[model samples]
Target: MTVATFDTAVIGGGLVGCWTALFLARRGARVAILEKGSVGAQSSGTNFGNLRLQGRFPGQYPLSLRSQAIWEQLQDFVGSACEYERTGHLYCAFDEGEAEKLEGYAKVSESYGLSIERLGREDLKHRYPWLADKVTAATFSARDATANPRLVTPAVARAARDAGASVFENIRVSEVRKSGSGFELRADPDLRIHCANVVNAAGAWAVEIAEQFGETAPLFAAGPPQFVTEPFPYFMSPSVQTIDGSVIVRQTRRGNLILAGYPRTAADPASQRVPVPPQKTLAAMKRLAELAPVLRSCSVIRVWSGTEGYLPDMVPVIGASETTPGLWHAFGFCGHGFQIGPGVGLCLSEMILDGGTETPLEPFGIGRFRSGVAVSEKFRREFDERKTA
Candidate 1:
């Protein structure tokens, strides 16, 4: 087959990849996307749709806020329904340490001009009767939102295609190498992609593929095996589980409750692994009951799981690689990529096209780590010190 070329080749067609492609294409840059499966068929579509801006590390706080702005007006540009909803998020504090952390975050978030209201348990109970007593404190981010990922991402790809960007679905990249003044991508089952820059937004598989180009930055899987429940009324609230928690039960605009959460079991190493069993379901159900007592009546009609990568510092690496000069990273979201994907994708595209991002993408660079190794020890030590305070 003839080698397909573009000014830029985006390696993954998930939301991040599609957003990156469309954003760049809109700027008149030729863009192409290669997907290992149908567009937005993997983690981008599988996970819960939380356009949240709560409880994120202060460093990522600003990026998420910017993404929320894009999500607010995305449908206007897409010319179709993306199903953005004002399903406010209530980030709770189950312990004093958590409360302190929440308090600290709330103070700084205001400086970003985000309207996050902190509430005591009593105040929470008065406003919403759904919460359990286990919640000691909570912060409400009214700016937060949720969207049907199933709709938003595909629309992005469609828009990109409409704007002259080409997308290849189910064409897996087998190998990558620097070629001429650009790069060459070998796709399995057939096809080769040669372009000036290659983007790795392969969702769960990003780390594995990035390493083939010599990026060994210790990005491991994070998020639990998740599943969704049948449709229900507007309840459950668009909330998140913290203190390393999961069980992201949110009511869809279609009235179905999306049941999903993190589990302790790890996925197998061979491929994008996710195993769901009876025991796992039962344990998650129990946790769900504590968070929302009404969930006792809601039976778990289905279950699913997906793998997501985690950098040791709990941040993503974006921009030109130290070893692979033309390569740029857009992975390791630590399960929170969906909310900030638009901002990230836009920043990456800018970095590729303009040589540097106007937005603050420095905290997320690979250089933050110690020569390709993670700063997990520093992250843990700081986390512990915060707990004692």
Candidate 2:
């Protein structure tokens, strides 16, 4: 019979939402995170765990760099490393065209003050002898890192809770509407949450809340099919990916090889089911073997996918809401949410408390959808546009 009140109500418990709650609570604001399921049970936990700095959208460099700093000092920030490592990221190319693309990416990254090492064919072979002979060139960024996706969200949520934020799991928020000067969230199990501000970081299901506030984006649900092989020798250090977006493979300390690929599999957000097609798995396996001949005989033990929202422009919507006051949106990250999750959270907290952030988030404003979304070059090459709807 009693209603809960808070300074901010964060809808979704993934990395972004949890981190937002953590920072807000740490700043002495009352915060609550409403998650439909357990924390980190969605795309935040199922992603490839890549903290790649190269080949990112040029505009995202600021936030990415800020986030990488948080990840580097994760233990001091969240009290958990989450199996993080800065073992570096190697982007390889199989032909001249892809090789040229790698160079362009490296230049972009270098312009942003990130150190990038361009490697010729011989340099790659000399450094990584296990690489296939057909590889022509590569770009290595020692700053690009990775972490255990499975461990991060839960840890961050726990930190948020430790900082005095209330985390409510299995509470599906059905509606959020302006109530008086603030907003009220209606959820399952007869729960009502009143807060001065609301944050829509709901991952794949975020659009529903946005639409209610007279905002809409061309968001579609999809997931990159992922596979993990049985334990092998822990030789591979840095995470590796092909410039063509064929496959990305990394060897964990436990010796399991994790692989993910593009042309992502379509997912049903209504059912919360992301099924990995068997053919996609086979294709990823073949590409993985071609990347490293030594892993040709590795046995895949599992395959999976997670629901993630992708916008036509391949950038997220992060900023205050246009049609409604006291509301903010941070969703539709495509597949890059994991690495920048913390920085986005920090920016959101700043915007909510200090009235703005210095992160230059103008490019990702939700208002861009009204002017006609300009498809990014990466969106065209990374996904099958026909399936975006």
Q: Best lDDT goes to which candidate?
A: 2
lDDT of 1 by residue, 192-296 (tens): 878888888876577777678666567665345566676667755565554445456677766667766554345444566566767878877888788878777
Put down candidate 2 lDDT per residue, 168-285, tens digits, no spaces.
Answer: 9999999999999999999998999999999999998998999999998988888878899999999999999998778899999999999998778888998998998788888888
Count of residue pairs whose backbone atoms collide, per candidate: 9, 0
TM-score of each: 0.89, 0.98
| Residue 330 lDDT, candidate 2, scale 0-100 | 97
* Candidate 1 TM-score, C-alpha based: 0.89
**Model 2, residue 246: what's the lDDT?**
83
For model 2, state the Cα shift of residue 258 in Å. 0.5
Tell me how far the alpha carbon of residue 284 in candidate 1 is from the true structure, in angstroms, after superposition.
1.6
Candidate 2 ranges beyond 4 A from true positions = 381-389
